[model samples]
Target: MALSIVYGILTTVLTATSWRLGLAVDGILWLVFLVPIILAVIGIINAVNGKMKPLPVIGGIKILK
Candidate 1:
């Protein structure tokens, strides 16, 4: 959640600064933003399914907490 907000801000800032940074944000976000978001979604889904399990590497990233 927190990381998403940070990334959103950084993305908006960098995107407005230069086209290169904007491209970098798009490319990097697949691994950086998308990965964590996907993992978090999976974690939440599992929880809703009544399966207890952490989301791979993303579960440990405290930036969202």
Candidate 2:
């Protein structure tokens, strides 16, 4: 849930910027968008595979822990 929210927010914010700045900004938005998704994907993969894989900075920076 957290991963989804983080990615969704970043994606929306950056995408909004991209609308005015064009391709380079769009590319950056894409890059920023992947950060949280990659974490969630890794987490899902680890959970499904029966292992613990911490998402780089975020898994360590747990606010609700």
Candidate 3:
């Protein structure tokens, strides 16, 4: 959620700055969006098997309890 917000802001800023930079930001945003969907799929599989596993990179962060 935080990442998406930050990326949105960055994308807006970059778009205002330059078209080339905005395109680069768009590509990066796509990759960032994929991370959570992939993690959620893995998480769902683990849940079905009764396992509690953290995601690889973002799971360790204690942003919410």
Candidate 4:
């Protein structure tokens, strides 16, 4: 959610500056979008299996440790 917001701002600024840069950033973001989907699927699978497994990458971030 936050990522999308930041991406939106960046895309707007980059596109306003140069269409090519915006195009490149947009392309990269599309690929990056897959990460969240993968993580969500993993989380759902873990929950359904009644397993307390941490997600990859951002999973190690603990705010209530």
Best by TM-score: 3
lDDT of 1 by residue, 35-57 (tens): 76887788889989999775687
lDDT (Cα, tens digit) per residue for candidate 3, span 1-65: 78778888888899899989998988988997988799888888999999988876777899867
User: In lDDT terms, which candidate is top?
Assistant: 4
How many residue-pair clashes does candidate 3 contain? 0
TM-score of each: 0.47, 0.52, 0.56, 0.56
lDDT of 4 at 55: 74
Relative to the true structure, how large is the alpha-carbon lDDT of every model? Answer: 0.79, 0.71, 0.86, 0.90
Error of 1 at 46 (Å): 15
Q: Write the per-residue lDDT of candidate 2 for residues 11-63, one digit (tens) a residue.
A: 57766777555555556756876887988887888889999777667667867
Off by over 4 Å in 1: 34-65
User: lDDT by residue for model 4 over 1-65, one digit each (tens)?
Assistant: 89889999999999999999999999999889987798889899989999997777777899996
Clashing pairs in 1: none
Pairs with steric clashes in candidate 3: none
TM match of model 4 to true structure:
0.56
lDDT agreement of model 2 with the native: 0.71
Summed over model 1, clashes come to 0
Error of 2 at 10 (Å): 13
